[model samples]
Target chain A: MSGAGEGPGHGLGGRPTTGARTRSIAEAAWAAAGRDGERNGHGRTRLQWLMARFGRGTVIGIPYIWLLLFFLLPFLIVLKISFAEFRIGLPPYTPLLEWIEGGYLQIKLAFGNFLFLLDDPLYVVAYLNSLKVALVSTLIALLIGYPMAYAIARASPTWRAVYLLLVILPFWTSFLIRVYAWIGILKNNGLINNALISLGLIDSPLPLLNTEVSLYIGIVYSYLPFMVLPLYATLEKMDIALIEAAADLGCRPFKAFLTVTLPLSMPGIVAGSMLVFIPAVGEFVIPDLLGGAGTLMIGKVLWSEFFNNRDWPVASAVAIAMLIFLVIPIVVFQYYQHKHAERAEES
Target chain B: MTDTLVQGTHSASSRPEGSRPGAVLRRAEARPIIEIQDVVKTFGDFVAVDQVSLTIREGELFALLGGSGCGKTTLLRMLAGFERPTAGRILIGGQDMTQVPPYDRPVNMMFQSYALFPHMSVEANVAFGLRQDSLPKAEIRDRVRQMLDLVQLGPFAKRKPHHLSGGQRQRVALARSLAKHPKVLLLDEPLAALDKKLREQTQLELVGIQERVGTTFVVVTHDQEEAMTMADRVAIMDSGRIIQVDTPHALYEYPNTRYVAEFFGTVNMFQGQLIEDEPDHILIRSDALANPVYVGHGISARGGATVWVALRPEKLAISRVQPDSPHNWDQGIVEDIVYLGGISTYHIRLDSGALARVTTQNLERMAEPDITWDDRVFVSWRHDNTVVVTG
Candidate 1:
């Protein structure tokens, strides 16, 4: 190809070609070609550089965009609605921002909803009641789940698989169905009352359903697997030799568990507790289905405000306040996760 | 004071009324710290340890050496009170400890994996056993410091097990097990995880620690070299049975069976029939040899009884010309030569197609080859070097 290009320049011009003249002409042609090649190479590299940048941008930007569109955008919309005034309309709330004449923006936000929640004792009681219920149910779930997780982790390989399957088997049925099943078992004419009355332990059917006790049972039963799964993962990966080492060092079996097994499974405990606690605080179905009028929970109040009262602004305000209240625990959970990841990396 | 009190009670309880005088004398001379009497451990249909019996002397470093399924670890676990014998008994320091739980037994074990608590610092790990006894805080601190110093890990006491090197973690495990001053210390392949250089150094360190503490240490190991280097006496185990127990030197030089001889090191065996048996000397005619081989000592075997002569590779010498020795010599052609830095091994093939290995030290540097491949050579050994076995 180079020879063919050179043939046109050297052979067509037939004036007595001297050595110096031929060399000068070849050098000019070479310089021109070098300039063209440089331009082409630069353009190619520039395109490649942009392509590489786009590749990295896609990897990182996609997740950020997903969070923004699906999570952050919805949260901002709720926040905006929380500030708007309530009105009888198709959307049931007025817009907080409006454009006036001369292209000037006017903003109107109502603080009355937040002020009304603070003034009303019912909202305050519901918040406190929800927190108390969540705390007690999480404790119950932890107590029942820890021993189950430890047993499954220490079981033989074949038995371990079976135990894990049993732990997760409740998920096969619909969650709402499981919650509804608890009502039948815990009601006055249900299994527990009937069995107790038939055994002559009770003179009549006691009021078991539509009570705080039923709420606690439903929450614990539904969230028990969440508590056990993370705990099992941590306990199963634990080295059994540590417990044996403790026993060999003169520790009794129970003390060995406290000193070695319990301390080492702290990460799992924290993870499992967060998983159960976060969801239990906002629990609505169990409270609505099993809780009586005495059990005033924020989730049921929020549901009533949105659907029964047709109060969108107050419901949005309630949701925003609940999120704000939960931020501290969520931050604490994130800090724990971060610390655990760092510890893992160091080891 | 507590040690003496415990020992007194143990002896008073275990000693029979008017015990044999010989038994009392033996106890006074060198008491058996741990006695494993006819212990048998069976898992379902498989017998892990079959009626194994051994007595480890006080302040002795004993090793159980065997291959993987030979029940060495199971025997050690029994000593540690981790496994209950299906039959027979285990006694520690003259006390019946067969029914005792591990936490109550006066024994500690250094696990093979080092089993250091990842969540605790080295000082805490060493102090765990001491704390279990509810000792005074001041005493626990002093004892933990002393153990850390003994292991040369004073600077690393504040570090967790994961932060320390493998050798350092191993020392922590050793110090933790030794901290409580238990009557017996069991080590299960303690140095198996360390590299070769670290393993050799740690083996010597282990021996030193055991001697200084005067604790009866029963180490279970599959590496023959490690067992021989670290133990005062080695017990070779095979197929859930104690095959032989002897000092390392005696076990190597005078192995009673072909299994013991081969397990300790490489040995070449010749199957033969005993043709002549005298009081001082014996003759065996082997098919691998052109003539009958002679030994200095005789065994009580009838004529024409099948026997085996086990010869170690290092004991045999190879030469190009036939030696002046009248017996214990064979003519063969060198097939392969492995030149190790310190020693050279020559594989020679006899006329009967039997292979024999002869190893010689490179005492002098050789610029030119003295023996190369495919050279006809004679391999000979002293009559005392050959061990005869009749099964």
Candidate 2:
């Protein structure tokens, strides 16, 4: 096909127009042709045919629309609610915008919700405990996942698939059911305590469940796959020659691993940590089910504030504060991702 | 003190008197820096390296040249302590190194992909081995700087491997490997990753570095030209065994077997039988030629035994008329003429239904020959030019 009338300089009928106007006019013409294909006698035009089916904008707009609807919209709603006052009403929160007398608009935003969160020492302790649990669990997951990921990555192709599948196999079960199963394994009369008591390794049933230790175990077990998969991805793609080169340069095998393998897989480490830590910071179900009374986590606090105390505005404020707390790790994760992409492009 | 240290550690141990490039071939008594005794490496049921024994002299740039999967790389890995031989022992500087790990051994390797640490700067990469040795920080810095300067990568000391070009990254890998001044340096396909022009340039630069550092280098390459251009002595391997090991000149001029003759360069093999067996001369009767091929040398073969004569394309002459020598000349019709810029090759189909290739140097301005396709020509070679292989 000749591209005579397709470029920016030319319009139909040898007319001159600006590029944007030309584009709009062309789009209209294409739309008209699409509506009545036999009018032009050459069937539908290429632009009309293609754009009417699927264009670049529609392809790229799909994910944007998804994020806008599901993520940004919900986040804006939460932000708006966080500014409202708590009230004993149907929705249980005062509206930020309201119609007033004298035909004047009244906008009442209560900053007291945020101030109240700062005033309550219980909320502060819960935030700190949440961070502590998330940080400790993430470190534990990394410690356990790195070696497992390394083993899977170094395995043969056939065994590699099997090992990766094994890592993901736990996900096939219901998440809540798996956490409940951990309760059965960690409780005072559960599997470990019974085995230890029968083996004469302990005198009595240990207070294993409903404690901080059990909470750590539950979080680490659930998020360990998240850590291992990304680590495996990076480790599998890494050049094995680098390790060999390190060893050949008079570096011991373990030292080679510490120098080469660990540093190179930093991107995967950051990514996996962010994935586990972000959801973990606001994790609700695990702490609600497995945490003891002393385990004051922000998730449990947020849940009780919204449900038991019926304080939606305060819970929303706590959520917003938790987000502000997590922005640093998210930014760190994004920075590593950007650096990794830049290095990939360079090589 | 520095002078004594430099000489005492590296060149003093490796480089003997008169042990330069060409001179090393004559020094038969030069100390062997690496000795592989009956080394056999197997992966499961498949034997990667058979019972092979090799001795590499100190300060020699040796090449293990072969095609892919020919066990050249496997042998190099065994030398680097990455793979333990299933059965034999390796010695470096007359010490048993078979049971020793790579870090414990005094050897370094430059990977084919260069394998420069993407995270580390050029300086840090070169200093990696030195740091492992727990050298003083000041000494490590000085040696790193010296190594970078040696590879002409001083300006790129702060740059990461990904930030540099392929050639520059290769230089970084070289510098890193050479910084340790190990007893041996193994290079796995060092020039295989570069473009043709850069590969030729790097080949000479590598030889220069090897000589200046005075370290024994064992390089593995599938490219014959790379091996010939860079190696002081090349061991051509095939199918888990070394076919032959000799100087580049000798390997090219006098190949021992048919595989060696064909593998090193282009050759036209004629199936024949030994007709005359004499102390001074031997003659071959061939079905591929109307004439008997004469060699001005004796062979340890009986009469009427089957033999093959290998002649390089450049060694054979093409002419429109027959020469005075009737024993070594044959008449053939030109099937094709390949006019390369520097030289031209003529594919000649002999009357005996055998095809032969003859290359002539295009020395003159009008070197485009008058001889075209279907033109009859005579192909002749001197008796000494023929390489006879019993295998």
- TM-score of chain B as predicted in candidate 1: 0.92
Per-residue lDDT over B1-391 for candidate 1, one digit per residue giving the tens place of the 0 to 100 score: 1343234334433434213344434534678898899999999999999989998888777899999999999999888888899999999999999989889999999999988998899999999999999999999999999998878888998998889889999999999999999998999999999999988767777776775688889999999998877777789999899999877777888888889988998999999999899988999999998667899877988888999989999999888888776678998899999999788899999988999999988887755668899999989988888899886
Query: iRMS values in order, in angstroms?
Result: 0.8, 1.0
Candidate of highest lDDT: 2
Model 2, residue B164: C-alpha shift (Å) = 1.4
TM-score of predicted chain A against the true chain A, for each candidate: 0.83, 0.85
Q: Which residue pairs show backbone clashes in model 1?
A: none
What would the per-residue lDDT of candidate 2 be over residues B1-391, giving only the tens digit for each residue? 1343344335423543332545655645679999999989999999989888999998888999998999999999988888999999999999999989888888999999988888899899999999999999999999999998787778888888878988888889999999999889999999888999988877777776777888999999999888877777889998899899887777888899999988998999998999999999999999999999999999989999999999999999988988887699899999998989898899999999999999988889965577889999999999999989898
- For each candidate, the DockQ is 0.62, 0.68
Once superposed on the true structure, which residue ranges of model 1 sit more than 4 Å away at CA? A1-65, B1-28, B324-326
lDDT against the true structure, each candidate: 0.85, 0.86
